[model samples]
Target chain A: MLTLYSFGPGANSLKPLLALYEKGLEFTPRFVDPTRFEHHEDWFKKINPRGQVPALDHDGHIITESTVICEYLEDAFPEAPRLRPVDPVNIAEMRVWTKWVDEYFCWCVSTIGWERMIGPMARALSDEEFEAKVARIPVPEQRTKWRTARAGFPKDVLAEEMRKIGVSVNRLEMRLAESPWLAGDEFTLADVCNFAIANGMQNGFSDIVNREATPHLVAWIEKINDRPACKTMFAHSKSEFADRGRKVTA
Target chain B: MLTLYSFGPGANSLKPLLALYEKGLEFTPRFVDPTRFEHHEDWFKKINPRGQVPALDHDGHIITESTVICEYLEDAFPEAPRLRPVDPVNIAEMRVWTKWVDEYFCWCVSTIGWERMIGPMARALSDEEFEAKVARIPVPEQRTKWRTARAGFPKDVLAEEMRKIGVSVNRLEMRLAESPWLAGDEFTLADVCNFAIANGMQNGFSDIVNREATPHLVAWIEKINDRPACKTMFAHSKSEFADRGRKVTA
Candidate 1:
């Protein structure tokens, strides 16, 4: 059986989960908690030295990197469905769009969601609790370095990142308006990647998504949210979020 | 015949040039001067709206993005030697290596070659010459934005980028030490991408690569440099570089 190592509520992990569910593939899911840094443990590092999820272990062959994993699944399970057109020109278009989704869209998710929203949410602590959390870092030098880097980020930087998010969302809305999915009429890997990150963005930061500003994008999100596979992944993820006592928009 | 719109001395442009030359595909080459922002011209934008060079017009179809262009050439000229393997695992491995070469190795090249080297070269200009260059931008606001961005980068940023180059060079050295190429024993698109960028990096920054620091990587570069197709691309690019008063290091 295939095993997927992932953490709940992570955009990176959601891509593979969505792909697997869409294909109706059966797999065992093992969750990693980023809050606990369990991914950095020696056992997990053996699977992925990068210490990032989602990592997939198919039989004995281990594959890491979200884009790489997605490609692998497409190849391994050709009977399931095609995520890209077979023709060279269409494949090229698919690849470029997939790359764009990963690079630009993923960057927006990291900058706006993780850095701006998630980081602040994680750090919402009393002064004593904050000091204790800082003290708990295994390496003192690393703690100091992290603090310095965090302190260097100006408020304007976050604002600029949020603006970039708006620009990307607008671009995505325009793209969705023309085609049902990110890559024309088909629900390709591009849509899977976009769906995962876009879902997180809309849910984590509703302020960024509104009918007035991004009506088309908001509607597209609803369309994807209604899919059976998406609903299943969202329900499972939501249960995990509830278990952790964190509010989940998905 | 295929037509390639390109500017010499760009790492991205070299990918398709090598692919075309290696596959013995006939193509007409048009040089666009980045210094004048000729790629951003309305005429050029119709071919590639991103306003970046190294675009290919194959028959009537237009293709942009170097990686996609190379893959397109491979598919179109399948009778020519296959640049990518057909097997799933091999294809996945090739994709992984290609992505790494594009993302990681290209980062080193952009940081070490363009951002670091090109700025000092650009800054040596007289005030009138610099102003004239800035005025060539079609959009006034874009010109202001470009000027401000260029003025903001410090020398240390380039130095830090060079350090990253050294780290990547070391990793490549280890990878090449085990196999004849970047991916494995076979010479695929991975080798093509690495050769193009490594050639440029060696030309601009010698300290990052040497017999001692990257013995295997140096050997790999020497082997690829000896290829007739690579030699042709290198020689053809010379006049373009000489026109810029910069020595050709392809």
Candidate 2:
């Protein structure tokens, strides 16, 4: 039995959801809403000591980290549809993109994301509610992020975030201009990992990621949007907030 | 033919070097000295657009990122000694530790490391010389990091870095207490990746990572130090500076 615990169709959660749909795998979706502090609950903590979402439980085995879980799905079920490149060289190319997303791109987008959406929700909470929620978070850095979001990200920090985002967009544009996907011809997990964040750009970061500024990225985003699996993942969104920064092209 | 372009026994460079030694693979080592700005030169940029070290050229295909390079080595050379777990679940467990080190542990350590090492090197440069070197760096965030290091990291930032390091040490201690290595019984790539950084702690952050405070971690370090491959990698160190933060057990 396979079970995936995730939040709404946000950045990290979108990864495995889309991959699972693409791979045509059957798994249970256990939604752990972060806005409601469900992820920090003791039950969820038992599942993942880190208390983070997008964790996959495969036959009594627990795998955390969205990218790692997706890779696990590919590794354990070789009979399933392939999302990774066959050649080790191509796979290395794919991993470089995914690693870049994990280390750099995701953080830049998530920082801006928390500031815009999560910041407001956190600020709306009562002082006691906010403190209680912050106290329950397992990671110290995450706790600091929550407290900072509630208080407001520093002006310089926010500027640096946007700057990083701009760089990511430009690099994506440059890469997509050369090939159909981030890792050459194939639509591998590199695309799946990056599209989660790139999908948010048309609506959230149109100032820097629009057609005029980043036509290749915009085109790539539309291509991924056309996939049937992408639609299925979007349909799984729980609320309008889940589709907060996503714009569907007709 | 495998050729690895890397620096000395520093954080990222330590990973591929140790993995190559452990796997018993022969490869050409193209040492790129960052201190001399060789990594940022035009010749090196052709190999890796990011102008970062620890890039592997497998035949004609080039792979960047230290962790990704190590994984590439595993995937391409199944005949070599295994550094990854055979079971998918164990692989996932191994990955969680490696990913955490890549995303969190390494940055905290590198931040402090840069302030102590790179800051003085950068500060010692002539104004024109520093500006010329900074202009050659491909990544914007890296440029900002170099500038900040030269200017000196903020006191608040350095304190936060130390706090993160303390958390990392405690987590390592807790995990080591349970198993012989990071990912249970077998010494996987997870050990190789973290050991690159953990090996530095004895001489560098001795205040927080000593045997008195973290006996399990200390024992694990000593165990890894006893490995023939570990000794081989350390022997390849270019300068006394390469052994700056490493303490050899008597």
Candidate 3:
């Protein structure tokens, strides 16, 4: 049996969550709500001292980091509906985008999400409560980020983040114009990873992401959304994030 | 035949270079010297559109991104002397650190390296030459970083980067004290990816990384340096970086 410690379904949490659904694997989903700062709690930290969500516990073994967890799933269970391609060449091509998601795309998308969506939710806590929450965070850099999110990011930083989103959109469009999927013709773990964030940002970046601006990416998102596994994954999402996913596909 | 487009023996480039050396695979090394801005040249862009080095060409196939390339090497060449552990549990553990290096550790180390080593080299180019080099860079974000490095990172940014380095150091010490090698008793690609940076930073961070503060990690670095591949790879490094590597192992 497998267990996934996640923040419902969306962002980094959704990669492994959707992968499990795609592979038709059963996992006990233990939700660690970041909005409530439950991840900063001691019990959750015991599972992952970093206090991040989307950690996987495979029997007695533990794996953290969504990208690592998704790859581990592929490695441990190489069944049909394989997330990565069979050929090494295509797999190499697929990883370029996955690494892009991990290194560049995720940071730009997360910065925008935090500034707009997560920050407001985190800021709603009282000063004392928020201060205590920040202190409890295991990593110093993460603590500063939470504090910054609560305080509001600088205008220049957010503007640069928007510009990066535009760059990300351009990169994705360039890829999708040539091939049906991020990696190539077939949907793989690359799609699973990219879709999670692309779907989340669709409504917010509608001006840049609409059918008119990024036709290929728009079509790709719609097609992936219609997949049965996508539907199953969305069925588990919390209301706020679920609404965003539904709106993007609707 | 294999072809490696690399920026010589630095952090990111060293990952796959050392991996190939460890496997005793022969590859023609084509240095895309970033100091001369060869990565910005059109021909190199054909090999990798984004023009980042450490891209591997296996026969006619292209693979970019250091972490992805290392993982691909393991997948395509799953023989004896595996770069990653064979056990699923250990591989999962190994990936955690690899992902950490990609996500958290690398950025901090790179920031320090840029401020201390690479930035000065880029700054040495004349104003007209630097502007020309900057204009040739395909990606906007990378262009901005190159410019920032030349101008020097903001004091607060550098300070925070150092703090994160401290966080990384503490985390590594905690892991190394428990396990003989990162990821377990068997050395894995996690070491290959990480050693490139840790060894690179030893001279600059001597106070923080010495035997007193981080004994296990220091010993681990020494043990990895003792490997024939590490010595061979370091022997190929340019003088400034070579001096740093030799000092740590000495």
Candidate 4:
């Protein structure tokens, strides 16, 4: 039995959620609400000291980090459809894409998520409530980001974030021109990981990666969006703030 | 049969260099000197579009990203000693360590490397030459960082980076208290990846993780340092800038 602890439709949570969906694996979603600071609660920290979501409890063998957790599901549960490629070279190629999400694209998307979506939600909270919530964030960097976003992201950082997003989108467009999938010819974990972040853009910043600017990325997003797993996963993902992001995109 | 393009031992390059040593695999080390901005040369861009180091070209197949490169070495050259555990669960555990290097620690260490070490090296360049060198850097974000570091990292950013480093170091101390190695009992790729960053701290910030503060971590670093593979890797790692880092630590 596998249980996945995750937060929302926008960030790292969606990465493993999509992986579980693509592989058609059965997992109980123990949704941790970030808006309530449930992840940083003492109870949750016992599960993961880092207090990050996308932690997996596989028969009490705990695993954290969405990247590791996604691959763990692929490795541990072989009966499910293989989301990672078998060839080592292809696997290496696939990993680069996941690295892109974890290291770069996630930050760009998250900057926008905080500024446009979550920031508004946080601003709506009373000063005492917001300061209390920010203080509870386990990671200092995140606390600074959330607090800053609530105040409003400076134009420079937001501008740089948008530029980075453009670079990510442009690179994706160029890559899709070659291989049908991010890893190669077949759908794999790379697609699942990339789709998690790309899906957010479709609703929240449609203009950044629409047909005109990034035709290949837009087409790729559309094709992946239509997948049964994508539909199923999105229908189930939860977040008070991200739900609004979904509505705005819708 | 293999070619590895890299620069600066302290950053991403040390990761694969250590892997190659641990596995006893010999690849052509096409050292791209960062001090002269050789990595940003047009020829180097053909090897890696991002103009980052630690790109491995196996025969004709090119793979970039230090995380992928390190694992690819294990997968392709199976005759060598295995740095990754065979058990899937252990493998998952190992990946968390590498993810820490890639997503968190790399930034912390690199922030210090820029502000404390390489920043001085970059500033030593003449004005026209420095401007020319900066112009060649393909990635805009990196160019900004390089320029910012040359001017000396703003106090606030460096303060935040140092705080992040403390967080990463504290987490390592806690994990080492539990297990002998980052990936449980075995010396795995996790060690190679982390050592790349941690090795730098021994000289640059010795007080932060010495025996008194984190006995386990200090002992762990010393043991890993004494490994024949690490010795051999450091002996051969080439970069004008990193050569200085090595001397400082030595």
Candidate 5:
């Protein structure tokens, strides 16, 4: 049995979850809470030295990196709806789309969503707790340097990221408008990758996903949300997140 | 004949060039001068809408992105030396290494070599030429916002990037120490990727490749430099770059 270590709202974990769901593969999901720093725990570190989530422990061989894990799953289980086309041209298209998800989309979500939204939210906490949380950031020296550098970040940086999000969403809308998916007429891993990032942006940075700026992207998101598998995954994740929140509150 | 649109001294273009050289495939290299922003020109943008280089026009089928281009070449010309492994495990390893090269290594090199080193080099030009070069930055707004936001970027951001280069060199050294190639015991695309980056670093940032800091990496660079394909490609690129530089200087 494959054990998938994941968290509720992380887009990185969503990649593998979507792949598992898309492939209809049975796997055990062990939810991790980054707020609690569970991902950085010693045991989890043993599983993934990088201490990042969405790690697939397949028959004891650990595979990290969301894209690599997703590709591994696609290769290991090729029967379910082919996530990738076998033809070289189609494969090239898929790779470009996948790279876009990682390079452009992921950057927006992480910077805009995490910095503009999550970091401020976290900072609103009690000083002691906030300090503890900050202390727990992996790679403390690097994180400190980044945070310090980020402190001087322009006030409009968030707005600029939002604009890029707008452009990205517009592009996605154009792509999805032409074809049902990011790649083409078919649903593939490209859609899965896009969905994860879109969901992250929608949840964490809703202002960027408004109909005015990104009507097509909003519509595409709604369409994907209608999928039973996607719905199931979201419902499960939401419930799990709420349950975990309640535990912390208690 | 395949048409490869590329700029001199980019790791992305080197992947396809190395593969073509290894396979002895015939292709015409149309060099783009970054100094002139040729890649973003209307003609080149038709080849790659993203306005990035290393775009290959193979019988009218355009392919971009280094890894994807290499994979496409491998598939299209299987008689060529195999770049990817056949087994699932080996493929997984290859994918991870490839992603590492594209994501982490490329980021380090660009942040350190290009942004810090090359940008300053380009900026040290006549006012008209410098302004023209600066105007060509793809995401001017985003770059401005990022630079503003990182106003207090550790005075040592460049130093930090250089340190990462050291770390990268160390990792590569260890890998080469274990076997003649990056992936244990076999020379695959991984070697090509590493060689390209190392070659660029040596040519663009020699300080990072000192014998005291990374003797093994230095040795590995020499070994890769000795390869017939590598030697031929470098000689061709060197003359081309010299000619282009002289034209620009004139």
Candidate 6:
């Protein structure tokens, strides 16, 4: 009844993947590996014109954008465990965190991830293969990013990105200190979205994110990792980056 | 009691302001003049730590982010008219457009706007006054943007921004040709969020958004403008840029 087009359980892909698990929803998982540029292929583009992943196909309808997909699941299947809060004020808080991840947190993590991991992977491809792959990307900005990744992101851009990550991490630390979760006492989609990237911060950004520097953030990551649903989501990884996706959570 | 702290009926501010009008809700409007750096003032920052405008205080709970505020209005005031579609698929579509506007469209428009309009305003200030204004901005990125605007945005950056605007406009035109409103037959928040920025494009960036090039978008604008609520919203403008906000619809 449901099929999720995702890139395993990391970054944007992990948001919906974890949400589905937490909601006790069983659906097909169609992995669209970014490493091979499968997301930009014609078949994938047919499903989503923009060719971005973490899209949910319910029956004949299609939904893109990971945060939107999470909200869609909440809207379409109301009987599922509510990842969204019932109180209007709490819901507003949930959304602020979700939007924060989309606009601020995830991009910083992705920029660093692409620079450290994806850049090497892209650079490994043959010149002919690389050019062909870059040409196939549907979004012009994404294509530019891919080329930049392969060539190496500018040092200043990376530095600024790292600085942003520091700011975001510190904010998370401060927020978690005040409340049990990003949106207050209850676990909501805010935690789901933030953890998708925050989990990565603990591992890849150890220098900036650790018990000594960010004890609250570190504790929250552990709390999220201890969940049964999170375990299932991590174990659900089937892509080539399965190890990378499962590493911190495993 | 509902109280909205906004710049005016334009850009991000128009989203909640127009939504309230469409819902037929009466609320107190607190106009925060950005030209005078009121948003960065201590009192405004107490309302929204980010020092961003277009924040809603429902009763006493504070809500920030223009799109999130619009959704908050929908959730908090369910008895009011629904700006969101009842169907899950349609809600997803509405969110996609809203998110696109927030992520892709708004920044480009704002970049151009600041360069053309705010640059002159900033340049007019005395050297000491400009530095003092810049120092008051809480967010580092916003402070950097203000400094950039005063220095004049890079020629290539503005050119690139224009190119992106053209691409976004063309996409809107193509989408409008197929759907009656952005989310389908229903006039949803997608139209509400988009028309806020699109209406400005028609007037300020006529070179790219004329009726000849974007008939469907132009028609959609006229359709939205024809709404009595839109007329009321334009008339609700109280900032220094009131005329600029009301001009397109007038």
- Best candidate, lDDT: 6
Question: Which pairs clash in model 5?
Answer: A153-B149, A154-B149
Docking class of 5: medium
Model 5 bad stretches (over 4 Å)? A116-160, A237-250, B115-157, B174-180, B200-206, B238-250
Clashing pairs in model 2, backbone N/Cα/C closer than 3 A: none
What does the lDDT read for residue A216 in candidate 1?
A: 81
For B64-159, candidate 1 gives per-residue lDDT tens digits of 888889888877788997777776666666777777776666765665444443555557777787776666556444565456445655678667
List clashing residue pairs in candidate 3. Answer: none
In candidate 1, residue A113 scores what lDDT?
45
Candidate 2 lDDT (Cα, 0 to 1): 0.87
Residue pairs whose backbone atoms clash in candidate 1: none
Best by TM-score: 6
lDDT of 4 by residue, B82-179 (tens): 99898788999899889978888889778877776778888788888889988888888888888888899889988988988999899888989999
Candidate number of the best DockQ: 2
lDDT of each: 0.71, 0.87, 0.82, 0.84, 0.70, 0.89
- If scored against the real structure, what TM-score would every candidate get? 0.86, 0.95, 0.93, 0.92, 0.84, 0.96
lDDT score, candidate 1, position B30: 84
lDDT of 2 by residue, A4-104 (tens): 88885668988998899999899888887776888899999999987898898988888999999989988999999999999999998999899889999
In terms of docking quality, how is candidate 1 classified?
medium
Each candidate's number of clashing pairs is 0, 0, 0, 1, 2, 0
Tens-digit lDDT string for candidate 2 (B74-145): 999999999999999999889989999999999999999888878888998999999999999998778989
lDDT per residue as tens, model 5, A74-124: 777778667777777877888888878887778765665456434545655
lDDT, candidate 6, A1-250, per-residue tens? 9999999887888899999999999999999987777888999999998789988999979999999999999999999999999998899999999988988888887898888777888889999999898888888888888889989999999999999999899999999999999999999999999998888677678788999999999999999999999998887777676565345234
Chain B TM-score in candidate 2, rounded to 2 decimals?
Answer: 0.96
Error of 6 at B244 (Å): 5.8
lDDT order of candidates, top first:
6, 2, 4, 3, 1, 5
lDDT, candidate 6, equals: 0.89
